[model samples]
Target: MSTAEDREELLADVGDRIRAERHARGWTQAQLGTRCGLSAKVVAHVENGQTSLPLYYLAELCCGLGVTMSALLSDAWVMPTRQREERALTPRQAHILRVAASTGLPLSQVAARVGTTRQVVAARLSESYRLLGVSHLPQDERRAAAARIAEERGLFDAIESYAA
Candidate 1:
């Protein structure tokens, strides 16, 4: 194939992988776009292979989809089955955990964004750490540990609709 054809084929394959991930999470394009700070139109264009996206946007999509850049690009990657424990976290807990883990925001800021007090945010985070079985770690390491576990289990994938 010509270089142009090869590039188009690659884009199409990547787009298919993206769409599969999104579908596995049961998220609409708009919802994924919201998580990634892009518009649904942009997501649609990417999924349809109608346009090439910048690496930055692609990275954002991976984050939003809770997949690694390498996973998204790899032909050998497959969606892993989620365990029951992965869904143990309530939507609220998942949202709070997600924001806390991903944003690098202070507790106060996180609380404000989640519409709760700092104390509540801390409490919820503690609860999350326990649920994720990371409470045994030092307090400082709990959040990062929980985040890593959550991401691995696809807990950050489909954020259920909740008032936040």
Candidate 2:
């Protein structure tokens, strides 16, 4: 279990990452809000850590930002309670993401091999990204975003390399 303070810190980080991604795309809060069917005030709230949006709205944010929900979340999405360290992706989730990033395989095909449906795989990937605090950008964009974050954290080498 996590302490309240831990949760707050995680949400704040999530908010910061969202703001960074928005800025990376050169989008104003109003512009991003318009694309996500949110008001500028709502966007401000989300970006400033004043509030947390529902999962569905976060998904919309991913779509509006042209990133995968996973790409938007990054690795700091969760911190282990006992170890007080970052969470690592499960092997299955990592495999799916690496495959998606490294290859152009359709989610359905990936699903076939992974023994899951496309929707499930997508949902899992999105959840994994949320766990990792990764964004959901297209492969190239996601790689760049992940690389930048990893570099800042001194984790570029440890972070998984996405296919170009």
Candidate 3:
């Protein structure tokens, strides 16, 4: 079981992840709120890293995000405990990851977009491979995998910009 602090962090991270995805789809808070049967304020709160609702809200969020409660609750979305040393990658790495995840752009393309070398992009992707235990998949492959688990319902083309 997680401590209260851990739970709070998890809730906050889930909010961030979901809201980011929602925004990527170009959906506004109001639109996501409607999808989740929440008020826009509530959606804003959640996206602002404030998710303090009952389990039903979790269900609604999952439905709205086209994911499952399990995936949302999974460590990937859940915030890390304080004791956990894990951290997000550096900006360059993060940008590389987002592009790779969103478009699965080739390493050369990612390097071009980020004004970096292919080797740098390759190194960053290698880290993801160590963490995910496989080479990262193209957007399509990820969608296929998600579909097997009833996940990856669609694209979030809203908030995505080249992480300049």
Candidate 4:
């Protein structure tokens, strides 16, 4: 069995991966929350590592994030942040961000992965950007902006390096 410290560390690692994935997609916690049928506060809790990611949401999160569950759980999945005040992530948030940004999968397919209606996915994505401080752009422009953020942060290259 794992010690409490060990468990905390594991949770922290999971949070890190989630945060990394979120940043890779340039999503706020609120955006991820919409995709996963969760609240922003809950999303923040997950990202901050203040609460453990429940097993029940694990699959939903994986589906939403567009990443294999194994990758999220793996130790090799590090995505360190430059924040002076650090945070972690909830599985749901991570999943939503990963799937929406990384997968390039169709909306219906993504919804299928999460066992939800495509309408829900679409609403979540819409609400996500709507909550932003900045004005929303079209999908392609938003994706390009996210890609730029990822590149500036070196998140994609870091993940690739770990994969190699």
Candidate 5:
């Protein structure tokens, strides 16, 4: 976002954008939460950018907010710098993450579609945590749950794949 700022500002700017879009649609945080299947508190956090959005959820939120994915990619946003270095993951881990991000499937749906269980998805995300150099993330706290993240951020721009 606007130059001459720190990473926190960048995160807040992204949050503000999400809030702006929500207001534009005349949707309350709760309403948007319902759309995203997240609690309002989570939406508040993402709008604040206090957490690094999992790339998969970021794409979903972009679609749900009626914004392009590129909207979230400007300098306005930054992944937490301490983790997720360039050389952290194996090729397989990276590919799986990419697939999750691009697929627009919520964790459970993603698992189901692949004929697996949510535990499998959780394992993948935990692997992602390691790959990203983060600590192990509990299932609920993991940042990749599409529906949960969308609801929390009032993300109207998620891919809307369920309707298809």
Candidate 6:
């Protein structure tokens, strides 16, 4: 295939993945678009592979979909299954952790976004660390460790859909 054809194929694959993830969440294109601060027309064009999305838009889509960029872009990527013995985080905890992981914002800022106190955000993150079995790490490293664990376990992937 020519370079153009290769690009088209890649776009189609990405579009399909996005569509599947969206459908799995039972979200309409408008709903996904709303979450990503985009228009439904943009979502439609993306899903149809009729347009090229900038990296920012793609990142926004991944955030809205609660999936990693790799998962969305890689044909060989598989969603990691949570182990039976692992404790599941509450929806609020998951939300908090997801924000904490992705945004790299201060706990206070994260609290503002989550509509709670910084203390509450800290407590929830503590709980998430425990649940993910990363609390034993040093205090400074706990958050990053927990985030890595969550990402590896696909806790962030499809989290929004599952929480809903």
True-structure RMSD, every candidate:
14.0, 17.8, 14.4, 17.1, 18.6, 15.1
lDDT of 2 by residue, 1-164 (tens): 56977777777777777787787666789999999998889888887777866887788777887777676676644322222236556555665665565565778987887677999878767765665566656654663354344345543333345312
Q: Give each model a TM-score.
A: 0.49, 0.44, 0.42, 0.45, 0.38, 0.47
Off by over 4 Å in 3: 76-164
Best by lDDT: 1
Better of 3 and 5 by TM-score: 3
Candidate achieving higher lDDT, 1 or 2: 1
- Sort by TM-score, best first: 1, 6, 4, 2, 3, 5
Q: Put down candidate 4 lDDT per residue, 26-85, tens digits, no spaces.
A: 778787777777777876777677797897555555565677788888757666444342
What clash count does candidate 4 reach? 11
The lDDT per prediction is: 0.85, 0.68, 0.63, 0.61, 0.59, 0.84
Q: For residues 1-164, could you state the per-residue lDDT of candidate 3 as single tens digits?
A: 66988878877777787776676566788888898898889878776666576778778877986778787666666532223223334445455666666566787997888788999878876764443333456644642332222212122222245352
Residue-wise C-alpha lDDT for candidate 6, range 20-66, written one tens digit per residue: 88877778999999999999999998989999878887999999998
| TM-score of decoy 5 | 0.38
For candidate 4, give the lDDT.
0.61
Candidate 1 local lDDT, 89-137, one digit each (tens): 7778888998898887999999999999999999889898988899999
Q: What's the lDDT of the predicted structure labeled candidate 3?
A: 0.63
Q: Per-residue lDDT of 1-164 in model 5, one digit per residue for the tens?
A: 54645667766777777777777666777877777667777777878887666666556566666677675566554343222223344433443444565576687886765556778776765676654544455654445553243334343233234223
Best candidate, TM-score: 1
Error of 1 at 73 (Å): 0.9
**Could you tell me which 10 consecutive residues in candidate 2 have the lowest summed lDDT?**
76-85
Q: How much is 22 displaced in model 6, in angstroms?
A: 0.1
| Ranking 2 against 3 by lDDT, winner | 2
